[model samples]
Target: MTQEQWTAVDRYFTDLLVPPDPALDAALQTSAAAGLPPHNVSPNQGKLLLLLAQIQRARTILEIGTLGGYSTIWLARALPSDGRLITLEADPKHAEVARANIAGLSDIVDLRLGQALSTLPQIAAEGNSPFDLIFIDADKPNNPHYLAWALKLSRRGSLIIADNVVRNGAVIDQSSSDPSVLGVRRFNELLASEPRVSATAIQTVGSKGYDGFAIAIVTTDQ
Candidate 1:
């Protein structure tokens, strides 16, 4: 079907399931007004993340991206009062907008400003390993690196989710020189070869067009 049809279906499902939230709407609006890339997750996708975090009983979360804190709010909502979430953003402008968007969650959400490659190490040094859940959605070229850090920061039973793996079904292109595609390919290969985790990716279509998420559960620390 066409993207229009997919988006229409997404709207129908969202209207039926995902209720309107003033804060979420404002986050989107502010992001657009600030000219940030429209890379935030769709409302339904955000709800899925929320449900997954809740099901995992995640007390600690690590997010590799914080575009405008749209998904951050959704994931943070899944946490208990004492729960904590650390989200990394490299762009100063995006981080500023996200900071405003998630201001209410200042206590629950830690927005780190720096390249994730840099900040992730600091998080580990600070003994923030064994996060209950990790979401990787930053620059695609660094997805493999992010996955490596996710593994280092996770424990057995921890859930790891990576977004934009499908890239409109371009992931299967063996000849693709696109850095994002190459990164996802390597990430998938690593997941397949790594015996410590069991994982799978599912293709999806919605307002964002064809894309998918790679989900994995760390099964062994050995």
Candidate 2:
């Protein structure tokens, strides 16, 4: 199928399966007002997250970025009553907005204001209690580092989803050498080569653009 065709399919499936939530909508508006980068996952991506979380019955989820808690709300809402999500954001201003936006979800979401690299290692040192789901949407340059950390902390059956894998398919052009594109390409290579995980890249387009993502399921024995 053509790229546009695939995008249409993605839109159709997402629309058919997931509807927007008021809390998430409010959070997106708040993020926009705060002048933060539009880093929050798309609603379709949010639905994919929810579906993956529910599939794993994820009790503990770790997110690398929480722009304004829009995606966090989607993931948290999919969990059981006692399930929890810990999200990291480097920008304190963004974190502030996220905290405010997620105020009503105090029971299930923890917004950590700090570098994800630092936070992730701390979580790893704490016995690496195998996260059921790990979502990476932080600085693109740190994609490889994030994947390594996630692999160390994820269980055998955990799901790891990385956003912006295609980067408008610039990742396929090895000669471009852009940091973000190179980083995403490296991430895809690692996931493809690793015997511990099985993954597939799905091209998607929406408010983001002619881009896509990768969903890797950790399948190795612990």
Best by TM-score: 1
Residue 160 of model 1 has an lDDT of 98
lDDT of 1 by residue, 57-170 (tens): 999999999999999999999999999999999999999999999999999999999999999989999998789999999999999899999999999999999999999989
lDDT of each: 0.96, 0.85
TM-score, candidate number 2: 0.90
* Per-model TM against the reference: 0.99, 0.90
Candidate 2 ranges beyond 4 A from true positions: 1-17
lDDT of 1: 0.96
The residue pairs in collision within model 2 are none
Could you tell me how far off, in angstroms, the CA of residue 150 lies in candidate 2 after the best superposition? 0.5
**Candidate 2 residue-wise lDDT at 186:** 87
Q: Show the colliding residue pairs in model 1.
A: none
